[model samples]
Target: MTHAPSPASSDRFKSFSEFYPYYIHEHSNQICRRIHIVGSALVLVILATAIITRNAWWLLAMPVVGYGFAWVGHFVFEKNRPATFKYPLWSLMGDWRMFFETVSGKRRF
Candidate 1:
């Protein structure tokens, strides 16, 4: 298993491939990962609802619903600061990737 990067590490990842192991490491906690998966699933549901109903309001709640659940898991369960604060785009990508990986049985749920 790849060791998680230290919280104090100052290394800046140049690629998503390089960052993903660290992303997975950060979510080592089962409950935290489960929460994130739920959040991502809700995000997909909200997106489909918005598109199907032509209601843009649901779109506004995506980030709130997604980030809210994720933050709770990070602060309460993982007891670690989110990687999002430092790597917004990569973190978002990581969330979705992790979600799919978990759901597809590539990673433990």
Candidate 2:
């Protein structure tokens, strides 16, 4: 038996600029996109707290908190796999950009 590459893995983006549109499309569902924003914001807060308190453990919880909400959104609302599995860097950039876009009022939450 042979395994097929996931669509995300099949297309290798040369730059984050190239992947962002696709990233936006993947998060088309309103609830799913909103969850991502909340998750990203929580991650930032945890990082800030970690820095202020000098507690490194909060840093460890970042990925869990961030990806936990995002994965739920993808699995339950979007019914799709997360791009992070195949495109970590681009996916991270997409998450932050999407968060900022939402905050900036460029993209509706």
Q: Summing lDDT over every window of 10 consecutive residues in candidate 1, give the lowest-scoring window.
A: 1-10
Candidate 1: tens digits of C-alpha lDDT, residues 46-91: 9999999999999999999999999999999999999999999999
Clashing residue pairs, candidate 1?
none
Best-performing candidate as measured by TM-score = 1
TM-score attained by model 1:
0.91
Residue-wise lDDT of candidate 2 within 1-109, one digit each (tens)? 5332334554687677777877888898899999999999999999999999999999999999999999999999999889999898889889999999899999999
Q: Pick by lDDT: which candidate is best?
A: 1
